[model samples]
Target chain A: MEFEYPIEGGDFTRAGMASSQVKKVLKQLNIAPAIIKRIAVAMYEAEVNVVAHAFKGTMLVNIMPDKVFIKFIDEGPGIHDIDLAMQEGFSTATESVRQMGFGAGMGLPNIKKNVDELQISSVVNKGTTVELTTYIS
Target chain B: MKLTEVVNKLELEVICGEDLLENTVTGGYCSDLLSDVMGNAQEGQVWLTIQVHNNIIAVASLKELSAILLVKGLKPGKETIETAIQQGIPILRTNETAFEIAGRLYNLIRQS
Candidate 1:
């Protein structure tokens, strides 16, 4: 099954809706709670990134028999250094984002830790795309 | 132990989720960082933090956390309380700091 959800940047109120929706799908499919938890964390972090940084984003979820794949595409000033962003303490978040208890530079690291595979590509002034996969079977 | 018992013992104010006070407490985690709670907090664990934003509710629900305890007398915004109610995530508040509440909670759970 496949699903797509839009994320509006700077909209803290709606930040995690996409992840929450995908979580519901996982539950209805009776996916193991352990697997769901991992995906939920990854997806939530991915969603928060878009909301906190990008202008807007879309989450495309592809759930297969063996694995669940999610692709996040966003319009924003992309990461200047992907490696630095992946570090535990590096962040480009503005003051407001940090005030929300996020922007500690652990978002990408948290996503990486929860998912089996994570791929990130970005253009400095263009946009970013993050793809993650978790084998649920 | 039940969330109600924890609230009564700690004199925590139920900011929302009155009906959810009966939720069973399996464990507890104390963190204000969203990433830490998301990555490390276990299911059914009561999260202790001073974060009063709406995202706290999202994290609590995503982790299947039993409840959220806001220390240092911090209170969530009106929208946050609404979100907590909608998401069925209980929010408790206390005048003590995170350290104080965490220490007390640790002892309370350990004793039981």
Candidate 2:
């Protein structure tokens, strides 16, 4: 099955909606609780990243019998250096975002730690795309 | 430990989910960072933090946390309370700082 969710930037209140929904779906599918938890963490960090940095974004989730694939596409100031951004302590989030206990420079790295596969692509002035895949049986 | 017993011992004011306080408490995790708790907190653990927002509810729920203990008497907005009520996750409050409360909670859990 497939699903898509729109994320609005600077809207902290509505963040995590996609992750929550995906978690619910995974639970209903009787996926292992541990796998569901990992997906929740990865998807939530990605969702919050969109709210913290992007102008707007979309989360696309495709769940198969043996695996789940998710993508986050955000339109905003893209990462100039994907390598640097992958570092645990690198973040360009604003002060306001930091004050809310977010933007601790752990978002991407945290997402990477949880997912079995992570691919990040970005253009300097346009946007970014994060692809995540995890297998569950 | 039943969540109700923790509330009584800690003198936590119930902000919501009063009827659901019978949740089992296995442990506790303290962090103000959302991702940290999301990455590390175990299910049935109570979360201790000063952050208050609707997203806190999301994190607590996603982690299958037992309850949220808001230190410094910091209260979430009305919508947050409503969501917690709906989710059956209790929101408890105290006027102590995180440092003060964590110590007490650690001792409580240890003794249990």
Best candidate (score: lDDT): 1
Q: Calculate each model's fnat, 2 decimals.
A: 0.81, 0.69
Per-candidate TM-scores read 0.98, 0.97
lDDT of 2 by residue, B12-106 (tens): 99999889889999988999888788888999999999888888988898899999999998988998998788767899999998889888878
**Reference-based lDDT, residue A51, model 2:** 93
Off by over 4 Å in 1: none
Candidate 1 similarity to native, TM-score: 0.98
Give DockQ per model, in order.
Answer: 0.86, 0.79
Candidate 1 per-residue lDDT, tens place, A1-137, comes to 99999999999988897899899999999999999999999999999999999999999999999999999999999999999899998999999888878998889999999999999999987899999999987
**Residue-pair clashes, model 2:** 0
